[model samples]
Target: MNPGGLDYNYEDWTTIMNMTAKTSVLNLTQEEFIYPGNRACSGCGLSILYRIGLKALGRDCIFVVPPSCLTVMQGLFPIAATQMPVLNCTFASTAAIATGVRAAMKRLGRDTQVVAWAGDGGTSDIGIQALSGALERVEDIIYICYDNEAYMNTGVQRSGTTPQGTLTTTTPLSGKAEASKNIPAIIAAHNPAYLATCSASYPLDFHDKLLKAKEIKGLKYLHIQTPCPPGWGCEERMTVEIGRTAVETGLFDLYEIEDGQMKLSGPSQKLLGKTSLRPVREYLEMQVRFKALSDEQINVMQAEIDQKWAGYRDTF
Candidate 1:
């Protein structure tokens, strides 16, 4: 029972949460912001992420893209796949460019959000400096890193966000010497107005996040795990299921931090410590990239997740 709040048992809680989520989905208009007929892969997770993100953002915004899969998805100059205005920037200047756009719009009194959408390679690796500078200045823009983990557009090379024990062109069987860079933790230290990790597995959660960020001013960093079909060596149609397992397995916990307060949400909220948690093996066995991992390597991966869980638990 929900003492003093509402008399409800476990079943009632489940029904209420489901209804709340369903309401969120129905709340979004049926208007299609992201146009079809792009060069996106068969089941590209980022493409799905873009579609959902735009639905939450509506058409009253601009998209800033760098040399990533998104740029490819948006298509060549004059002709584009996306419906809204898109500005292409250099590999390491997406955030810097977005900052300028937001500044210009503010000066001109334009009521619109400037979204800097980039990939893991651009955000966590090369573009990190520019992004940090923008956030330090508290740039009034929304920066989202659609993390596919590796540089899939450039032949599946290992990126800064690529996890350990995963086979990439650069990291092969031995896998990365070090663990994936703790990007979310690093950015969380900056303490933006809003910071969250998301996955395409849950559309309603992803949409709600973007919608909430749109209302907040200043830097809003969203790191979304968009599992690459070919890069991660998973079936194209299995992306959503993999995304779900990724969270349940503690590989990609969904949580949001606002002004130094960190709160777990979505699947991760229930999985914290003992309420609910799934084994990492199920998440690992499905991906070819991880299929070649040795017992020791898998153990290392488990250790990493354990540590991450402990840290988040401590935050409470």
Candidate 2:
């Protein structure tokens, strides 16, 4: 209760934020990240992750940003949200561009972390070839896919990451027969140094994983769960809460893999381990995608969730 007049201690709340707050002006002398003026929505969770990620990684980094919502949010030529050196590449060549940057950095004897940031549509679908090529070569890069579950920049079209029963431009309320692509396992199949899934709801887990990714030398991948208000048909303020609920309800699990071995990083895993699985409806109710779901369709979703959760639990 130092200054904010909260019940819990400030120290404890800081632990919750999982970000190193600049206690004084001296801390501000280091460097700035994720520039202040940009075009993100009022409560965009991806922006929150970008801010924290920049704080943790510092400015001694180069970004390989591709075409996506982040590209739009960061703005067109002459305006960018990130203060660090950003290399804008073609939509399907983010991984290839990142590999090139890493190789150039090594040749110049410069020690700088090269990160490739792309969207779900970019990584899981369009950029898969480039990503596979980079991973196969084991390039020194950190690839982070901010998965909003759809092609938000392209008018909320469905991507491989979009879950079933959702109402996207391509997959309307008629219901999608295909399942959401499992991106972590897809990357893990490449056997990179590190791979994980993160959400803003669990900031500490996110920070820890990023720190670990920085320590590793080879390719590191993080697939982050980001919620979009306009895309998901949810209120702006519920952005972070929606992410939290995704993990709590097991619609998305906070997980990681190292040298081919897998791990779960949050308390929800333990809770899920001991308790009976909750209804998928409990999770879907928060978003408008399921608004048109019939009782039969809801049952289909429930069965799918049960099977998926069982398989995930077995992996533990």
Candidate 3:
């Protein structure tokens, strides 16, 4: 049996290994699952990630979304942006709902994938209990948390995943005092079948990871760093650029862990042995949220990034 309590199949493992080859942008499917004219903001990073993600998941999937920006983006009632079926749940029950949906699918002899999509607040704060329970039970589902730093869905409040020194509405003057939660590390402890970190800037990378996760049984968790324009105080068009800068500066990484082994994805892989990464200040300067950050604070953040990469070098 796999770590997730599912019956292990050697052939399935081989197939998954063979499919790890990177997908090229040119070869991506032309099919679009999300229709045009949605409520998503201009240059919303989640929109980009969602569009590419659906292509990778295909039509044989059901989505469990909570009260988030995504719920607003998909429209209301009679109109919807996505072609697939979505069940909107409360802020704290995303994983529980997904588990129920997966159980129903199995009872009906259907192979449809169940996905739980939520923002950082919903995942790291409000919904973590359900997520942890699902992971521990080895529920068959894909749980995706798109971290935009703060709670953008409801007036930009501070969330558990919000980084230190970010100027969210709740942390107005002094910025956030506590460090951001390391959610992936927490999820890793549950020993899920698969886990990954993705960036909204790299759609194909996220797509490939989802495709890989789809073939695996039991729980798979993917945490993606998605940039928000109004919340982050950046121009709308710079969302993708800001997201890419996060990876280049070591603020965020792209990687996957399967069967207890971790591997860096392409963008971050190329950065492994580099002498230095782009300054974290460059990433900070791009966002208005960090406007009040002092030079000392920036230096401290840079040191933390350097120290992190040093550890990565030792491990990878």
Candidate 4:
């Protein structure tokens, strides 16, 4: 033992560190899904989300993106930022069309995965009916909502998933009145095969979730929290940093739901205990969207976080 009374060896640290590097390489496929030259904004987390997600899903999959930032960033047909086949669908019919595509693939006896990608506005507001229908039918498709918390491409309007006290075009002064919609809970009620909330800052964890969702046969939903550079009024470079803060502050915990049970995953698993989170102000102060919060508003937001964390802990 060292003088500090801790049992440690150079060989032990070396082995663990070496294994970490090797495992990271093995966990991810060495394939480039997004080619160079795309029009995505600098430090756009959605761009990162799409790049990592498609790599995990690989080329054999067919992706369907509705009228979202992704659809626009993907460019017109015949030329795209992605290397795989992507289908453009109407704003309100993403899940419905993906369901049909999966059925067709099943008939053709192809094991290719079909994924429906939508924004929070499309998934929670406009496309909820179609999404509910698809989930009820237990379609063999993956539906991912890359939630930037508002309708970014259309305008910085408030979305159903927009957190309380966040500034938006519609909620300019007073901020969003209600708390963010818990879409994962709504989907869990339908008893789908898989449900998870992943973040853009944690791509390896997100990729692992996608890989697991791919193996499942029935409905699977992944809600990924990405940062919008212009919408959130933060620096373009702060995208990943803000995302990490959101998770660490207990504002966005990662979890997986399968077999009718919900379990917190990643850093969120440790956060199952009370006092496992950093201060919420650290998360909020970074973005200009939350620069207007008063002392009372900060207290309110903290209470909300406590209640939410407690609820999840009590559930488990």
Clashes in each model (backbone N, CA, C under 3 Å)? Answer: 0, 0, 0, 0
Regions more than 4 Å wrong, model 1: 1-23, 273-276, 310-315
Residues 93-150, candidate 1, lDDT per residue (tens digit)? 9999998899899999997899999999999999999999998999989999999999
TM-score of 3: 0.93
Model 4 worst lDDT window (10 residues): 1-10
For residue 295, what is the lDDT in candidate 2? 87
Q: Rate the local accuracy (lDDT) of all candidates.
A: 0.85, 0.79, 0.90, 0.84
Model 2 lDDT tens row, 190-239: 89999999996665566667767888989999999999988988999888
The digit string of per-residue lDDT tens for model 4 on 245-309 reads 99989989899989988889886787776556788999888888886678899998888888988
RMSD of each: 6.8, 5.1, 6.6, 7.1
Candidate 3, superposed: residue stretches over 4 Å from native: 1-20
- TM-scores for every candidate against the unseen true structure: 0.90, 0.86, 0.93, 0.89
For 48-117, candidate 3 gives per-residue lDDT tens digits of 9899898788788999999999999988889999898999999999999999999999999999999999
Q: How many collisions between residues are there in candidate 4?
A: 0
Candidate 2 lDDT trough over 10 residues, lowest sum:
21-30
